[model samples]
Target: MIRLSQDNAKSLLAIHGWSGALLGLLLYAVILTGVIAVFADEIGGWSSPLQHEPATALPKGLGAKLAELSTQVDEQYHDDLFFFPQAGGRIRTFFHKDIVVDGQPSAEGVEFDLDPNTLAVLDRREGISETIQQRNTAGALSAFLVDLHVRLHVPNPWGLLLTGALGLAMMVAAVSGLIVHRHLLRELFTIRCRRQDLLAKRDAHVIAGTWNLPFAFILAFTGSFFSFASTVGIPVVAMVAFGGDQERLIETLVGVSPAEDKTPKPLADLDAMLADAHARVGVEPSFVSIAHYGRADARVNVFTPPSEGHVSSNNLVYDGATGAFMHQKPGLGLVPSAGGVLFDLMGPLHFGNFAGVLSKAIWFALGFAACYVTLTGMLLWATRRAESQAWQRLARATIWVGYGLPLSLAASPIGFFIGRSLGIVELHDSMAIAFLSAAALAGALALSLRDLESLRRVLLAATGAVLLSLPLLRLATGGPGWASAFASGLQAVFSLDLAMLVGGALCVFAARRPNARLAAAARSGIEDNQSQPA
Candidate 1:
C-alpha cells in the first residue's frame, strides 16, 4: 500500500509539473491565435478589399469569371471543383481529389485569387500565381498560430495526438491548481500589493486564476474535445454507445443526414434555391453544399447562423435540383444527443464568433486574460523556487517564450507584405522563412537573457511600431484609406489596426516598469516596491 501510494504521489507531481510547463507556452500561443482568428474573415477581407468594396453591384461576369477559372483549374489539376462565390469577402476555388502526391494521398487544399471585375483572371496569367497562392487573411495568421497551438503544425493525426496529450496534461493541471489554491477562495477578488512581496505575487495568481476559472475550464474542455475526438476515440464511443453501425452512429450523435441522392440532376438556379432556403430558415444562407450534381435527386444543404442569446443544434436543408425543403433540426434540447450538441457548440463556443461584434470583443478580452493566466501560472512555478539556478534559468526561458512569440508573430504580416512587394515567386516559402527567422531570433535572445528589461522594451517598441504601420501598409497596397473604409462599412481593417495600436501602447506602458532584475524580484516577492534590484 505504501509503495503504491508513493508511486501515485510521484505520478501526480510529474503530471502537475510537466503538464503546466508543457502547455503554458503553447496555451499562450493558442489564446493569442484564437483571439485573432475570431476576425479571420475580416483579415481575409482586408487582404482583398476590392471584393467587398462598394461597387455599383456585383460585376456582370461573375459567372463567366468563375467558369473560366474553373475550366483552367480543372484541366490543369484534374480534380473536382468547388467554387465559393463571395466566400468570406472573396471568391475561393477549391480543387479536390483522391490521389497520391509525394507518396501521400488525401492531399487537399484550395487555389484562390481575387475576384475580377472583368472576366480576366486576377493575375496576368493563369495556374495559381504567387499572389493568389499567398494567404494573408486576417484570420489566416491566427489560424496558422492556432495550428501551432494545437498540433505544432505537424501532419493532421500527429498534431491532434500531441495536442490531445497536452490537453490531458492541462486537465490534470487545472484540477491540481484548483486543489493547491482551494484555501484562498475568500481572497479571490482581493489583491493586496502592499503585503509581503511573495504574498502579493501569490495574491495576483489567485485572483486571476479564480475569477476566470469558469472561462478557462470551458476553453480547456472544448479544446480537448477537438483533440480528443481523434485521440480518445470519442467518436468510437458514440458508435458503441448509440449503435454498432458507423453511419447511423454519426447520425445519432450529430444528426441524421436526411435522405441524400447519388444521381442528382444539375442544380438549375441558385437564386431560386437561396430564396426557398431563406423563406424556410428566416436567416441569410451562409453556405450551400451541393451533392451529386447533375443527377436526378440532388441535395443542397443550407446552414443557418446560430441565433442570438441561444446555442442551437438547428440546421436547415433544401433540395437543390428540386428546390424542396428537406428538414429542419434544432441543436440543443432535453435529451439532446451528446455528439450533436458537441458538434453544434464547437464553432460558437470555441471561437466565440457567433454573437457578432460585442461578443467577439468580449471573447478577445477573455482570451487575453487566459494568456495572462497561463503566463502567471508558469511564473508562479518558477518564482516559488527563485533561489535555484534551474528556476532562474526557467524564468528566463518563459520570458523569452512569452514575449518573443508575440514579437516574432507580430512581424509575420510585415513579412508577408514585404515578400509580396518583392515579387517572391513562392509566397508560402517567403512567409515560412520570415516567421521561422523571427522565431529563431527571438528564441536566441531568450536564451542569452543579456538584459531582460532591455529586451522587453525593445520588443514592446518593435511591436508597437509594426502594429502602428498596418493602416499605412493597407493604403500602400491600393486598399482604401480611413475615410473610404469608414464610408464603405469595411471597418474590420481599421478596427484591427486601432486595436494593434492600442496594444502597442499597452506594451509601452508595461516596458516603463523600472527594470528587469527589479521586475523579476518584485514578481518573486523578494523585493520592496520602493527598492531597486539587489
Candidate 2:
C-alpha cells in the first residue's frame, strides 16, 4: 500500500477529485464511445449488410476491376492505391496521391465502394481524404461512433491534441487514485451498503476504480501514444531529423526509398499476392496498399489484424510487378526495433482486437467500469460541495450528461436507419442531428424536472425505449429477421439485436428503481433549483 503523510494525502485527494470532475466529463465521453466502439465492426456489419454473404474479403477479379476503376481517376492518383473490406463485407478502395494539407501529410483522391459479391460500384466520392471518409455509408454508424470516440467529431491535429491531453489527465487520475485510495486491494472488496448514502457511493466508486486501474493505465498510455504519434510526436521528430519535411521522414521510417522507378510495368496479379499473404499469415489481411502502382518499383503491403495468440498485427510485403512474396515487414524501419514493436503493440493494447471477440468483450467491460468510476467520482465531488448553489449546478449538469448521453446515443441509429430507408446519401449528418436533438431534449427535461433522480429515471426510460425500438427499425429498413440472419451467416445482426433488447430491458429495470445516489445536500436543493431554472 502507498503511504503518504496526512497533509500529502489530503492534497492529492483534492487534486484527484477536482481534476477528475473537470476532466472526467470529457474523459467519460471518450471512454463510453470507446466501450461501444469495441464492437464497431459488429455494429457496422449489423448496420449495412450486403445482399449476399461473400466467401472472402479480397474478392476475385478485383485486380481487373481496380484496373478499370483506375482509368476513371486521374493519373496522379495512380501513385498510391489501397483497398480494404468494410465491416459489411463491402470492398472500399482508395486511389489517391499523397499531398500535404495544413502542413501535414494528407490524401487527395477518389474512393469507390464496391459490392463484395458482384463487384458493382455502390458509391463514389472525390475529395480530400477526411471529407470522403466522412461521406462513407457502408460503415457509417460505426465510423461515426469511432470518430466520436477518437476525436469527438473534431478535426485533426487539434482533435488529436485534445484527446491526447485527456489521456495524460486519465493517467494522472489513475495514479492519484491508486495513491489516495491507500488500501486499493482491501477496498476492492469492502463496499459497505449499510453506510451513509455518500459513503456507500464512494465505496462503490473506489472499488470499481481499483478493479479498473491496470486496464485504465494501459488504455490511457496507448491512447496518448496513438493520439500524439501522428500529430505532435511525428511532427517534432520530423522537424528535428529531416528539417520539417514530414513526407521525407515518413518515407525514411518506412524502410527503404528505392530509386524512382517510374518505368512502366503492368502490375502483377494482386489477387495471387493477397492469397499468398492469407496463406502465409493464416489471417485475412485487413488492408492492402500498393505503392507506386503500375511501376517497376511498386511494392504491395498487406496488413493483417493480430492473428491468434498475438498482440500486434503483421505486415507482409510483395513485389507489385512479379507478385512474388518479399518479406514480412515490420511497422517502422527495416530491422526489428523498439519503436515498431511499441507502435504495433499500442494499437491492439488500446483497442483490444488482439483475440477477436473475447478480447473486445473484456475491453468493453473494463471500459464500462472505468466510465462508472468517472461518473461516480464526479458525483462524489459535487455531492461533497452540494451546499453551494454553484456545486448544485455542476451536480445537475453531471446528471444531465451522465444519464442523457446514452439516450442520445440510442437515438442515433434511429436516424441512421431512417436515412438509409429514405435513400439519403451522406448519413452521418442526419445521425449527428438526431444525436444532438436527443441531447437537447434531455437537457430541457433535466432543467424542467423537479428532482435529480426523476431526471435520471426519465432519461433512462427514454434510452430504453429507443434501444428497444432499434431492432424493429432495422427490420422496417429491409434488414433480415433474426432467424433469416442466422441462417444466412449474418450472426452479427442477430447478436446485436439481442444485445439491444437485453440492454433496453436492463435500462428500464434500473430506471424503475433509480438507485443512483444524488447526495443528501443536492437532493435537498433540487426542489429550489428546479424553480430557479438552472
Candidate 3:
C-alpha cells in the first residue's frame, strides 16, 4: 500500500512538473517577443542609419513630392488620379490604383525616395543605398515584425488559432502554477536565490509568477479571446445563439450591411466628409473609411484619437452622398458596450502604440522581466533533467534555438545592408529564410555536443561577439555611426544597440557561472529525498 501510494504521488508530481515546464517555454517565447516588438518602431529606427532624421531637418517638400507622384501617375496610369499623403517619419510608397494620364493607365510608375530639400529622388542605386522613407511613425519593418510576433508570420486565421492555443496553454500553466504554490501571494516580493537550487527554483517561480499574475492573466486571456473566437467562440455562439448559422451570428454580433437598391450617384468630397466627421467626433481625424462611394447609400466613417479617461469612442459615420451624419456606432460613450470596449482597448494595451515613449519603456521593462521568467523556468527544468542524456540534449537544443533566434533576427539588418550593396532587391524574405536556416543549424550543432555547459558557453560567446560588433559594422558600411544616431535624435537606435550589448554580456555571465555546475547534483539529491524509504 505504501509503495503504491508513493508511486502514484511521484507520477502525479512528475506529470505536473513536465506540463508546467513545457508550456512555460512557449509562453515565455510569446511574451518575450511581444515585449520587444512593442517598441518595434524604435528598433527599426535603430536598424537604419538613414532613419535618424533630426526634427530640425526640413519636412520633405509636399508640393514637389505630390507633383512628382502626379507625374509618376501620368507616366504609369492615365486613370483619374488621387494623391494620398503619407504620415511623417520614415518614407515608403503605397501605390494607389486607378489613375489616368492619357485616359489609360500607364505601366511605368516609380516611387522615388526624394531628397527633402530638392524633392528629387535620392537615386543612389549603388553600394549601401537608401530607400525613400515613409511618413508614418511605425515603418514597414516594425509593422511586419509586430505581425510576425502575433501571427508567427502566418495568414490571419491560422496564426490566430495557433497563438490562441498557446495562450490557452499559458493560462493553464499560470493557474496550475498558482495552485501549486499556495504561498505565492505571501512571497510575492521575495527573490530567494540564496537557497539551494530546488528551493531557489521554487522561490523564483513563486515570486515572479505571483507578482506578474495579473499581467500574465491579461496577456493570456486577451490573446485567447481572438483565438477562442475563431476556434471555440464561433462554434458555441453560432450553435446556441444563432441555430448554427455563422453568417447570421456574425451579423448579430457586428451588424449586417443593408441591401443596395438605388442607382449610383456622384460621390461627395472626402475632405468635406472628414470635416463633417470631425465636427461629430470633437477631435481631429486619424482614420477615414468610405463604403460605396458613388452610390446614394454610400457611407463614410472617420475615427479620431482617443482622449484621456475616454475609452476611444471616436468614430463618426456619414452618408457619402449627402455628407450627413448617421447614427453613431454603439459603445462610444463613457459606459460603453463590453465587447466594443474590450476590442477598442486591445490595441493600446497590447502594443503600447497609443502611449508615447515613456509608457513604451515601461512596457519594454515588463517584457524583459517576462523573458527573465521564461529563461529561469527553462533553466530550472534543465536542472531537474540534467541526469537524462536525451533530455539534456533536448533542453540544450531548446536554449540554442531560443537564444539563436533573436541573435539571427538582429543579423537581418546586416543582411539588408549586404543585399542593398549587392543590388539584390526583395532581400527581406530571402534573408529571413537564410537566417532561420542558419539558426536551425546552430541549434543542431549545439544539440550534437556532448557537454551541455560547453555548448551553452559557445552559443553565449558567439551571441555576445556578434551583438557587440553590430554598431561598428553599421558604421563601417554607409550606415550611420553611434554619434550620428545620437545627432539625428534617434535615441531608440542607441538604446537598442546598447541593450543588445548588455544582454549579450549578461548571457556570457550566465553561461560562465561556476555555481551552475552543481545543479544536477542538487536535483539528484531532491529526487533521492522524495524516493527514499521513510
Candidate 4:
C-alpha cells in the first residue's frame, strides 16, 4: 500500500541485497545457534538430569542450611546471597559481596553446591564470580550453545561488539527488504517454479523473508540491545550520572537504597517464602535473592520465570526478617517507567521463552525459517555473480557453513556424555575441542569436494549419523534408558531421544535427494556417473 520513488526503491534493494550478502552467513550461524538454544533448559535437563526432579524447585530446610553456612563465611559476605538450581537440579548458593576486581566490578563470594534433597554441601568454591562460575558443571552443553549464540565464543567486549554489529546488519536487511518489495502481497504467494531457476530461488527467498520480517526485526533489535547494554549502555549511563560508579548504577536500577541496619536477626524461613511465591504467581521462582542477609532491613527478591499468558517474568519482594509479603516490582528502575518496561520485554521477545515449550517451539520454527532466508539469499546473490572468483568463494563458504555447522554441533555432546560418565572435570574443554575438531574435518570435506551439493549431502549425512547415535551414546555413558526416564517422569530425556531419532532419519533422507537425481540421470544416460565440480 505504501509507495517509494524508483530511485528510493533501487537504493533500498541495494541496501537489502548488500547487507545480507556481506553478513548473511554469520547471521545464519547466529540464528541457527539461537534456534538450538531455545531448548537450552530442556537440553540441560535431558543431558544432565538427576534421578528425578526435586519435590519443589526450591526445597524445604534451605533456610537452616543457609544460616549454618553463613556462620562459616565472613560477615561482609552476607551483604548479598542468592540461590538457584542447575545441572541435575542441584542447588547453588552464593553468599557474596560485590567488589572491584582488577578495576572491574565483580562478585567475590563463597559458593556451595548443595544436594537438593539432603541439603548437603556437595562442594564449595570461593573466588571471583567469573572464575568460580567456570567450575560449574551445570547445563554444560546448554551453556556452550548460549555462549556461542550470544558472543560467538569470543571474549568480552569484542564479542559483544561483533554480535551487536551483526544485529544491526540484520535490522538493516529486514527494513530494506520490507521497503524494496513493492509487490509484497503478490510476492508472498508467487512461486515461479516453472520459470528460470534464479527466479524460482528469488521467489522462495521473498516468500520466506516476507513471512519472517516481523520476527527478524524483533530479534535483531532486542539482541542488539542485550549485546550493547553491558558494553556500551551501562558505561555511558555510569559516566553521565553515577560518576562512573558501576555498582552504584546497578543499585539505583535495582531500587535498593536502604538505611544500614546491621542488627543481627534470625533469617525468616525461606521455604515459607518460596511456597508463598508459588501460591502468589502459580509458578516457582527461577531464583531467590536476599540482600543484607541477617540484617534487620534485609529484603528478599523472588524472581520467577514467565507465567502462563504473560510476556515477561515477575519479581515478588518479601521481608527477609519475617517472611512477610511485599510489593511485586514490575520495572527494573526504582520508579516504574516506559524505558524499564521496554527493557523487561526485551528478554522474552528475543529469546521467546515467555510461554515455555510451545512458544519456544514456535520461535524455533521461525528461527529456522530465518536461517533459510539468510543462507538462500546469500546463495542467490553469489549465483548472479558466479563468474567472479570472490563470489564463487562466498558461495562455497555459504554451502559449508550452512550444512557443516549442524555437523560440528552434533559432535559437542560426544564430549559431554563421555566426560560426565568418565568423571572428567574438564567437560567444557572436551566439548570445545570436539566441536573445533569437527569444524576442521568439515572444512576439509568441503575443500576436498568441489561439488557444492555433494559437500552438503556428505555433511548432512554425517550430522544425521551423529544425531542418531547421541541417544545411544548417552545411554552408553550412564544415561537412563527410555523406560527408566518414563518411570521417573523425565519427559525431557524421552522427548529428546525421540526427537533425535526422527531428526536423524530426516537428515539422512534429505541428504539422499541429490543422489536420487543423479541416479535417474545416469539411468537415462543424460550425464556421466562421475560427479562434477562446481
Candidate 5:
C-alpha cells in the first residue's frame, strides 16, 4: 500500500474526487466509444459484407489496372500513388500530387475503388483529398464512431486539444486515486453489499476503480500522446529543429531520399513487388505507398501487420523504379533508435491489437468497467450531497447521460440503414439526427421520472429494443441474411448479428432484474449523509 500522512491523504482524495467530478461524463463517453471502435474493421465488414473474403489486399493483375488508370488521369497525379483495403475488402487506389490549398499542401487526385477478386472498378472519384475523403461512403458507421471517440466530432486542433486535456485530467485522477485508496489490494475484492445501500454502491465503485487503475493510466497516456502528436508535438518540433519546415522535418524523420532525381523512368511492376514483400514478411501487406512514381528516385513502402511473436511490424521498402528490395525498416526512423522503438510500440499498446481478437476483447471489457466506475463514482458523490437542489439536478443529469448515451449510440445504426437504403449522400447527418432524437427522448423521460430506478429501467429497455431491431433493419435494407452470409464466407456479418442479439438480451435482463436495495433506499428517503448506518 502507498503510505501517506493524514493531511497528504486528504489532499489527494480531494484532487481525485474533483478531477473525476469535473470530467467524468466526457471521459466516460470517450472510453465507451473507444471500446466499440476497437472492432472498427469488423464493424465495417459486417455493415458492408462482400460476396467473399479476398485472398489478399493487393491481388494479381493490379499493376495492369494501375497502369491503365494512370493514363487517364491528369499527368500531375503521377507524382504519388497509394493503395489500401477499405470496407468489405474493397481496395482503394489513389494517384495524386501535392497542390497548395489555402496556404497548405494538399493532394489533388483521382481515387478508384476496385473489387479485390475481379479487379473491376466499383467507383471512381476525383477531387482534392479533403473533399474526396468527405465524400467516401465506405465504413461510414465505423468512421462516425471513431471520429466521436477521437474528437467528439469537433473540428481538428480544438477537438484534439480538448480530448488531450481530458486525457491529462484522467491521468491525474488515476494517480491520485491510487494514492487516496490506502487498501488497494484489499479493495480489489471488497463489496460491502450487506452494509448500507450507499456504502455498498461506494464499495462497488472503489473495487472496480482499483482494478481498472493501471489500464486507465495506460489509456490516458497513449491517448494524450496521439491527440497532441500531430496538433502540438509535430509543429513544436518543426519549429525547433527544422526552422518551421514541416515537410522537411517529415522527410528527415521518415528517411526519405535526400537527392532529387526528376528524370522519368518506366515504373516497375507493383504486383511483383507485393508478392516479394509477402514472401519476405510472411504476412499480407496492409498498405502500399509510392512516391515520385515513374521517376528515377521513386520509392515504394509496403506496410504489414505485426508478424507472429513481434510487438510491431517492419515496413518493407523497395526501389520503385526497379522493384528491387531496399531495406526492412521500423516505422519512425531508418534504423531502430530509442525514439523509433517507443513510437512503434505505441500503436499496439494503445489499440490492444497486438494479440488480435483476444486482446481486443480484453481491452473492451476493461474499458466498459472504467466507464461503469466513472458513472457510479459521480452518482455516489452527488447522492451524498442530495440535500442541495443543485446536487440533485446534477444527479439527474448524470443519470440522463449515463443511461441515455447507450440508447443514442444504438439508434445511430438505424439511421445508417435507412440512409443507405435511400442512397442518401450525407448519412452522417442522418445518424446525428437519430442520435440526438434518442437523447432528447431520454432527457424527457429523465425529467418526468421521480426516481433513478425508473429512469434506468426505461432507458435500458429502450436501448435493448433498438439493438434487437438492428439486424432486422439491416436485412430489410439489402444486407445479407445469416444463411447467405455464412454461405458466402462472410462470418463477420453472422458474428456481429449474434453479438448484437446477445447484447440486447443482456440489457433487457438487467433492466428487468429486481433491485431491492435501491427500492429500500428510496423508501427511507435517505438522501443525505445524516442517515449513515450504525
Candidate 6:
C-alpha cells in the first residue's frame, strides 16, 4: 500500500474527487460509448446483415473487379487504393489521390461498396474523404457511436484535443484514487450493507474504483495516445523531423518511398498476393492498401488479423507491379523494433480484441463497472453539498444524464431503423435528432417527477421497451429474422437480437426491483437533493 503524509493524502483525495466530478458526465459518456464500440464490427453486421454471408472477405474475382473499376475512374485516383470488408459483408474499395484542399493535403476519392459474393457494385460515392464518409449508410450506426466516443461529435482537431485532455484527467483521477485510498487492496472486496446510505455508496464507489484503477489508467493512457498521435504527436514530429512535410514523414515511417515510376503498368493480380499472404500468415487478410497503384513502383500492404495464440498481427508487403511477396513486417515499421512492438501492442491493449469475443465481453463488463463507479462518485459528491442550489441543480443534471443517456442511446437506433425504412439518405442526422429528443424528454421527466426513483423507473422502462423492440424493428426494416439469420450463417444478427432481449429484460427487472437502501436514500434527498424543480 502507498504511504503518504496526512496533508498529501488529503490533497490527493481532493484531486481525485474534483477531477472526476468536474468532467464526470463527459467522461462517462466517452467510456459508455467506447464499451459499445468494442463490438463495432458485430454492431455493423447486426445492423445490416447480408442475405447470404460471404465465404471470404474478398471474393475470387476481386482483382478483376478492381481492375475494371480502376479503368473507369480518372488516372489521378490511382495514387492510392484501399479495400476492406465493411458492414454487411460489403467490400469497400476506395481509389483516391492526395490533393491540396484548403491548404491541407486531403484525399479526393471514389468509393464503391461491392457485394462480396457476386462482386457487383452496390453503392458508389465520389468526393473528398470526409464528405464521402458522411454519405456512408452501411455502417452508419457503428460509425455514429465511434465518432461520439472519439470526438463527442465535435469537429476534428479540437475534438481530439478535448478528448485527449479528458483522458489525462482520467489518468490523474485514477492515480489520485490509488493514493487517497491507502487500503486499496482491502477495499477491493469491502462493502458494508449496514452502514449509512452515504457511507455505503462511498464504499461501493471505492470498491469499484479501486478494482478499476489499473484498467482505467491503461485505457486513459492508450486513449490519449490515439487521440493525440494524429492530432498533435504527428504534427510535432513532422515539424521537427521532416520540416513540416507530412507526406515525407509518412513515407519515411511506412518505409515505402521507392523512386517514383509513374509509367503505366498493369497492376499485378491482387488475388494471388492475398492468397500468398494467407498461406504465409495462416490468417485471413483484414485490410489491403495499395500505394502508387498501376505504377511500376506500386506496393501493396495486406494486414492480417492476429493468428491463433498471437497477441499481435503482421502486415505482408508485396510488389504491386509484380505480385511478388516482398517482406512481412510489424505494423509500425518495415522491421521489428522496440517502438514498433510497443506501437502494435496499443491497439489490442485498448480494444481488448486480441482474444476475440471473450476478451471483448470482459472488457465490456469492466468498462460498465468503471462507468458505474464514475456516476456514483459524482452523485455522492453532489449530494454532499445538497444545501446549495447549484449542487441540487447538479444533482438533477446528474440524474438526467446518468439514467437518461442509456435511454437516449437505445432510442438512437430507432431513428436509424426509421430512416432506413423511409429510404432517407443521411441517417446520422435522423439519429442525432432522435438522441436529442430522448434527452430532452428525459430532462423534462427529471424536472416533472417529484422523486429520483420515479424518474429512474420511467427511464429504465423506456430503455427496456425500446431495446425489446429493436429486434422487431430490425425485422420490420428488412433485416432477416433470427431463424433465417441463423440458417444463413448470420450469427451476429441472431446473437445481437438475443443479447438485446436479455439486456431489455434485465433493465426492466432492475427497475421493478429497486434497491431498498437506494430507494430510501432517494426519498431522503441523498439521490436527488429534494427533487424540487432542481
State residue 183's C-alpha deviation in candidate 4, in Å.
0.6
TM for candidate 4 is 0.92
Error of 4 at 370 (Å): 0.8
Clashes of each: 17, 0, 18, 0, 0, 0
For candidate 6, the lDDT comes to: 0.86
| Model 5: CA > 4 A from native | 100-105, 516-534
Across 85-173, the per-residue lDDT of candidate 1 in tens digits comes to 34224444454444554543443434654453443434322233223333434224444545566777677677788666665666677
RMSD of 3: 7.5
lDDT accuracy of residue 46 in candidate 5: 87
In order, candidate lDDTs are: 0.60, 0.86, 0.58, 0.84, 0.85, 0.86
lDDT of 3: 0.58
Candidate 6 Cα misplacement greater than 4 A, ranges: 240-248, 522-534
Error of 5 at 223 (Å): 0.6
What does the lDDT read for residue 39 in candidate 6?
92
Per-prediction TM-score, please?
0.81, 0.94, 0.73, 0.92, 0.95, 0.95
For model 3, residues 200-228, the per-residue Cα lDDT tens digits are: 66566568766776667667777788666
Tens digit per residue, CA lDDT, model 4, 1-534: 459997887788788889988888888888999999988888888898777766766888888999999999999899999999876677889999999877767899899988787888877888888777666665678888889999999988888888999999999999888888888898889988775445566788889999999999999999999999999999999999999998899998886566888899978888899889889988888898999999898999999986777776889999888889988887578767898788789999998988778889999999999999898888767666665678878878888899889988888998888877778754788889889988898899988997777888999999999999999999998889999988877888989999999999999999988843322322322122122210
Estimate candidate 6's RMSD in Å: 3.0
lDDT of 5 by residue, 99-177 (tens): 9887656889999989899999888888998777665676688888888899999977788988888899999989998
Better of 4 and 6 by TM-score: 6
Which sections of candidate 1 miss by over 4 Å? 1-18, 54-88, 95-143, 231-235, 238-264, 329-339, 515-534
